[model samples]
Target chain A: MLELEIAHNWPGFQLQLHLTIGAELIVLFGRSGAGKSLTLRAVAGLFHPASGRIILNGRVLLDTRSGINVPPQARRVGYVPQGYALFPHLTVFENVAYGLRSSSKEVHHRVMEWLDRVGLADLAGRRPHQLSGGQQQRVALARALAIQPDVLLLDEPLSALDAPTRSELQALIRTLQRQLNIPVLFVTHQLAEAVLLADRIAVLEGGRLLQVGLPKDVLHRPARPEVAHLVGVRNLLRGQVRGISPEGLRVWIGEREIRAHWDPAAPPPPAGADLLVCIRAERIALVRPDRLPPPERENLMEGEIIRESDYGLSQVLLFRVYGPRLTPERDYDLEIEIPPYVYERLGLDRIRRWTIAIRPESVHGIPCG
Target chain B: MDWFPLLLSAQVATLATAINLLLGIAVGWLLARRSFPIRDLVGALVTIPLVLPPTVLGYYLLVALGRTSPIGQALEALGVPLVFTWRGAVVAAAVSSLPLMIQSCRAAFEGVDPELEQVARTLGRSEWEVFWTITLPLAWRGILAGMILSFARALGDFGATLMVAGNIPGRTQTLAIAVYDAVQANDPTRAGILVALLSIFGILTLVAAQQLGRRLAA
Candidate 1:
């Protein structure tokens, strides 16, 4: 287990992080320069936090208050920095064996085992410069793992590889993480990569951790608009609470009233309370214009496709409502996604006018306060 | 040609080159790894013997070891003489060539990546082991080149040797002095032979230095 509560002052930013990660793949997901990498560095003992404590496996790695700090080498944390940072002068085998100089013959056997595990045993004699970028990355991973660290930290390990190589390496990393059962803190900006590799994801912005939970929960129920945006939620509408019902709460967005599956744990939004309703682009269903309105239900709008972009597997469509923009007090834009097959079935490219239906459970509401 | 003086000159030049190569490596390593007040000033001082007229260095050595100075008196009390001796000539050559070795070794050491050293330390190698196994091997080429350059410089030292260790045939005379003596005696034939031998030695050292540099770059 790794528990950290750190507060540090950067040049123009302040970082305050509180997190507990068990022996699982916990991805620190955020946009560029959002302090995810800095957090990893701090945990690895490469960067000293100004205050607070870090404990790994019940051992105090850092405690600014108690004046205890472990140097990076002694912390026994394996850090695979971005771009691998492999020693260009050393051959792959030598690189992997570097951290094993003090060990006996058994350690040499372990090094070879790791090299074979990474599928680079045959390339051990080749220098780093002779290997492809992906191969170099594996060599770096093997070298880090040869030390058998307590925690493994990877900073955008896949960002340097090509797409196909990245996918393969990602699968390899997932397998390794499971086999080792070590607390791995993987940092990356790619949301899809985080969803695929992480058992739980922590979303960060502006040096703050906005939310940490299972990947599905963080994606389906972001705590803030910024978190929603960072996780690729596309439709955020400003609205006001109209009324509360036994089933759920009703919010008024523009001229349309919408129902949201109310989260009981959240503070009740007083009537007329301003709020933001978020919905994923893929959740907004497009219906034929001739379909009659469902009885007594809310959350329906007629809009025209103003722009569209093809993304191979899916097409993103931006819509402008026929009526005036959601009031000057509550401006909002709607977006929808349709898979390529769905687009062909709906003939969405030929029709500009359509009705978009947002299901209540699919729409999440957060009080603007 | 006086065969005795010629042989003595060759022996002194060879010994001086060998001594300078070892001293250069030691001093270069120190300069590369340690920092002290006036380090840059000391670095400049090392190279002063290279640029200053050889006669000036020779004159300074003469005063410092002329039996009147404390160092010279102490040596004399031990029944060892530096003045007008073959050892004095070797000392002068080593001093003249010291800068060349330091410069080469410094450049070589500077080329090694600091990250490699850090990695070694983290991998359980002590600082000394890292220097020997990783740092030295990587910079060996540059060190070799520097040693050779210093050797070549020491082989050609003339003015300093002449001033401190006078022109004692078969004892203090080096190749350069032998050639100069031959010229003063108006024997162009002997002078020509000694000058040719000096030229050959200079050319061989230059070629060796260039080849080693190219091999390292490759």
Candidate 2:
């Protein structure tokens, strides 16, 4: 377990992050300059914070109030910085041997063992420059793990690799973390990468942690508008709860009232409360105009196609919801995405007008940040 | 021609380069990695010898280390009077060549990625270990070129060595001063030999620098 509460003041940005990471992989997910890397560096003792306390596996690494701060050399934390930063002059064997300072033979054996574990034992004689990018990254990981740290910190380590190599190292990291059973804090801006590797996701924006939860929870039920946007929610509509009935909660989007679900796991808000609804583009389905009408519990809106685009595997359609009343506050232009097969099966490419059906449970209400 | 002056000049250059190697790397690393209130001032001071006329620098050293000055008196009491001695020539050469050493070293150290050092620290190596095992090995090629440049500069120093060491024959007369003396004595042949040797030394040092740089780059 690792607990970090740090407030750092840079020239133009201030980072105030409070997070507790369990022994699972916790990915610090955010855009560039979102303070994810800064948080990792602070935990590694490379960046000093103005105030905070950091505890790693019951060890107090830093406590500003008590003036207790451990240097990076004493922190005993494994850090794989961006670019791998392998010592260009050292061979892979020597690079891995850097952290092992005991008996020479024992160190050599351990270094070779780690090299073999990372599938670089044969290339231990080669320098970092002689290896491919993925090989160098594995060597860096081997060197960091040779120290046997209690916490592992990785800063976009796979961002520079090709797709195949990136996924290969991703699996290697998962296996290593599972075998070690140590808390790993990985940083990345790629949403797909985070979803694939993160046991829990912590969303950082503007130097603060906006939300932290399982990948499914954060993706389907983001707590804030910014997080909803970061997590790839394209259709965020401002709505007010009109009433709660046996069917579901009714929300007013523009002039049209739509039925949305209030998750039973979450506390129900009062009626007439203002909230923002997040519906992922993929969740909204398109129905042909001539098809049989669906149940009234589902949100059915008639809209004209304003824009459409194809991204190989799926087609994105932009639609404007049509209503009799025109309210300046209502932006009913909804963005919907359907897989290529769905696009072909529904003959979506043949029409300009269609009805989009949004399930009540799919429309998630996120309180404004 | 007596070979003693040439040998003495080589010896002085070697010793001066050695001293500059240590002083330059220390000051250069400090300047490259740290920011203090007087950092710019210290940088300018280190660069003074590079821009100052060699004769002016020699005069400044003479004034500071002359017999009547307090520092000179202290050194004399310590049995290390510097004026009119071969050691004075070495001191003159080192002062003149220090800026080259320091500038090259600073650039080299700055070129090194600090992230590498940070990673080394997180790997449980102390600052000293990181410097030796990571920083020095990575930057040594540039540092070597700097040392060679400083040695060549020291070898060719004339005005400063002539003033402080007084151009004594076979004792304090380095190759540069010997060439000047040969020119004054109307001995073009002797001057030609000494000048050719200095030029060849400079060319060879430059060649070595380029080769080392290429090898390290590869």
Best by lDDT: 2
For model 1, residues B71-173, the per-residue Cα lDDT tens digits are: 8998889888788998888888878888888898887877777656655555556678778878888888888888777777777788999998999887888
Task: Kindly report which residue stretches of model 1 are placed more than 4 angstroms away from their true locations once superposed.
Answer: A5-16, A31-41, A44-52, A87-90, A101-104, A203-211, A217-220, A223-229, A233-262, A269-278, A289-298, A327-332, A361-369, B1-103, B157-218
**DockQ, all candidates in order:** 0.28, 0.90
Error of 1 at A316 (Å): 2.6
Which segments of model 2 are wrong by more than 4 Å? A288-297, A322-332, B214-218
Please, what are the lDDT tens digits per residue for candidate 1 over residues A1-369? 999999988789988999999989999999888899889888877678899899999999999988999876677788787777676667888888877755568767887899999998888799988999889889888988888889888989999789999999999999999999999999999999999999999998888999999998788888888888888888788889998886688888877677886887766779999988888899888887677458346467777787889999999988776675654342236778889998899888798888778777788887888
**Against the true structure, what is each candidate's TM-score?**
0.81, 0.96
Per-residue lDDT tens digits of candidate 2, residues B1-218?
A: 78887899999999999999999999999999889999999999999999899999999999999898999999899999999999999999999999999998998899899999999999999999999999998889889989999999999999888888888897798999999999999999999999999999999998998897777667
* Per-residue error (Å), model 1, residue A329: 11
- Per-prediction count of colliding residue pairs? 0, 0
- Candidate 2 clashes between residue pairs 3 or more apart in a chain or in different chains: none
User: In model 1, what lDDT does residue A266 have?
Assistant: 69
